[model samples]
Target: MYTKPPIRKIIHVDMDAFYASVEQLDNPNLKGKPIAVGGDGKRGVISAASYEARTFGVKSAMAGNLAVKLCPELVFVKPRFERYHEISKQIRAIFHDYTDLVEPLSLDEAYLDVTENKKGNPSASLIAKEIRARILNEIGLTASAGISINKFIAKIASDYNKPNGQKTVNPEEVISFLETLDIRKFYGVGKVTTEKMYQKGIFTGLDLKQKSLEYLDTHFGKSGRYFYYIVRGIHNSPVTPNRQRKSLAAERTFSENLSSEIFMLQKLDHIAEEVSNRLKKSKISGKTITLKIKYSDFTLHTRSKTLTYFINDKALILDTAKDLLYQESLNNSVRLLGISLSNLNTEAKKNTAGLSLNKKVSVQLKFDF
Candidate 1:
């Protein structure tokens, strides 16, 4: 007689308004008030906003001036990346106490596989609760979690209850949970994809499920198969620790548009130095150099060159960027400039713990958490 495969237990944990919350936690005066973490200048953008700020339509990536207009009392604070990273390390240490299979998506969120955790506790939901509580007690920060059978569903579930809450989607409920989900709430679906989905009369997971695989593939290219499988609750990706870095980049947005190449050269030199320093710090190198240009009208352009040999030298990177800069005439005055290196030397580790897509969800199986 064959035995059924055990369902994988995955948990996604996300910190609540991380950057702004950090600022508030460190400064009592900023608590319970609308605050943003970023520069407050003509070209400044809000990197993060507190829950109070969010109520007033202040949000991350929104222009600082616009955020101020939306909420007259919005407070702008400079980002403290070093402090955030320090706190993130503390959070990751807490995660490792429960499981070794932790995949960090960013400093604020991660995916943990607690099926065979160090705690030896069978309930993933309890593990998530314990982790969140530890974060709060030890680091003085609140976290939210979503527990499910896979990363995709867990990630979406984590956002269901924001600002310090947890949600669990049992194996039996995965199909129904996904079917009723709003198209916009699906992890990878963005504004452009949502509009495209609406145009195709697909507003929910159920509607997407109704489309044939061939239709999805034809209309959505490679992403069609992804949608087809995920709606049916068939994601098999495993939690991977130490995900490889794909690219390194540095960019600057000018307060005023610059029309002259001389001015752009100075900016490019600074950017290339930053990128080269970062690459050296990480002990990584790449062959492809891409120069990104954003005109005053917001039109974007990119030029790239892939070298036979990898480079992490600032002079070489600057020379390549300068060549790309003069490769074509300026369409208009440039408002932003960026340099990025891809095709890195880092190797990706193979994950051998993926769940089987062929495994069936059994209602008879005990749902513990």
Candidate 2:
């Protein structure tokens, strides 16, 4: 008799409208009102929108002016990143109580492998519920969770019940669940891919499953294989505990577009200083410096130079950014300037010991939850 493979238990925890929710929590007066976290000026971009504002078609990344037009009552507040970070740390501490295998996607979301948790819970669904409860009780914020065999499915399930809810896709239901899922709901299928899939008559997982591997590969290139596997609930990515940072950056959008190089130099100097300060705070340096320019017309450009040795000094970053700035003439009036450092020292560190780096892990045994 052959032994069955063990099914992994994964949970994805996502905070609901994290930034906006935090703003509402801290200031009771902002509760139940339309608010956006960002500047309200012409160049301001909405970083996060409260659910109340979302009802009025306000959303993250929307222009502040457009957001205001959409909802006249929309309140724009500057982002309090330090406060967000502090709250994020508290939430992560709650995660550590249940599992060491936590993979954070951002300050607001994370993937937790509860197959072997510190809490010794056999049911991933129960663990997710407990975790969400802890976050609400201790940190005073609502969160949503999805429990499944892999990250992709768990991530999708997390959205099924929005704003303080949880869903569990058991091992037996994975196949049927994937078959009925909307193609747009599939992880990694963005607006561009969704349109292409629709054109190819692949609006649902069942339609995608009917296409041969060669056919999908021909149409989607390398992503075709990814689509094929994930549609069948075959994503094997593990929840890495020590996900390293690959880059650090700082940028500023100007209220008024700058036309002269002299005006741009002053802006670049400030951006470089911000980048350098961030690098030092993280205790990391990089060999590559990149300059990003966004024109008033909304076209973006970037130029980079890699040095033999890493540097994190403000003056060095400014000097390098200045060289890249003058390398080419201004394409249009500059509306935003940013500096980023990559090829980070953090990337050179060794992987955490005892963690499997394999892209695929065998799953033969049907898990209980």
Candidate 3:
């Protein structure tokens, strides 16, 4: 039986340097300058950097000292979480005005399904443009949008012209557009996977499309199947709305590794504080506490303990994290420490209805996110 492919209209909207842009908007003096939002301590990591800062190699997750070295004139500002959250809610409200199906990835990015929008408009590209325009006019921030038949293509197209621009990939042009795209630009292809793909001569979507499924599966495991289908413009992951968070976590890496157990415990205390604060802010609790440790040599290990009851207390989290820490001896000096709470008690929501790709094409949709 041959079925036609199901077609959907998805739009991915990503803010341009969200935090930095907000900072720049709030303060006129910071405009047109290389700025980053994060702590400036020796061990601090960048949370976000403006486009001006990015040109000099400053990037999120980079060490503060390294970012300073990259751009000598870079300015650092403390993050204002409360303001960012308020703005995020405002942006989401704008999305709800158009469609009810909006999946937020973070405070800055989201995937919106506008196949049947509230305004009765048939053009997805026009809706995306209006959304971006609303964001700029109402909130005083710039956003880029991408419109396509599915989430995968929409996400990639969203990055084509960043910093207040929009791109649309019509269903008919998806295959050719993907052919020229670099394999590295594909979702789920990380640095390690990109290097592996380069070694296998899979540099672009076209090269990847030429590989056999069996060969891909053998080389890339289950992800190989994803790569094979995605390169052929076959991603079907829906824009899930009102998704419950499965976990909350916080972690930090130190500038210098520590071998002392006492030093590690001190770091765990800070990590516990972070995780507890996040849990409280979300008004959620969980039973499982996981402790992740990364050694100076880059080796990683994790220990977790599931409690009988949910907890979000800082002291309890710290105690549980400490117990997990001592469960395993320190194999090497630690470079990073993290704590996470899972097995949450949030309300579960599922979308049972499935969309038809085409009457002839049958896809076994598996929920992965």
Query: Which candidate number has the best TM-score?
Result: 1
Clashes of each: 0, 6, 11
Between candidates 2 and 3, the one scoring higher on TM-score is 2
Q: How does model 1 fare in lDDT? A: 0.90
What TM-score, to 2 decimals, does candidate 3 have? 0.86
**Residue-by-residue lDDT tens digits, candidate 3, 1-369:** 333346788999999999999999999999999998994845677899999999999899887888988898999999999999999999999999999999999999999999899998889999999999999999999999989888998999999999899999887788888899998999889999999999999999999989977799999998877787787777767888977899899898887889999998998988899899889999999999999998877788999999999999999999999899889788999888999999998947554443243433333332111
Which candidate gets the maximum lDDT versus the true structure? 1
Residue-by-residue lDDT tens digits, candidate 2, 1-369: 223224689999999999999999999999999999995745788899998999999999888888988999988888999999999999999999988999999999999988988988899999999999999998899999999999999999999999899999988888889899999999899999999999999989999989977899899998998887777777767898988899999888889989999999999889888899989998999999999999988899999999999999999999999999999998899888999999998895554223232344233436688
Residue 146, model 3: lDDT of 89
* Each prediction's whole-model lDDT (CA): 0.90, 0.89, 0.88
Off by over 4 Å in 2: 1-6, 348-365
* Cα RMSD to the true fold for all candidates: 2.9, 3.8, 4.6
For candidate 2, give the lDDT: 0.89
For model 1, state the Cα shift of residue 141 in Å.
0.9
RMSD of candidate 3 to the truth, in angstroms, is 4.6
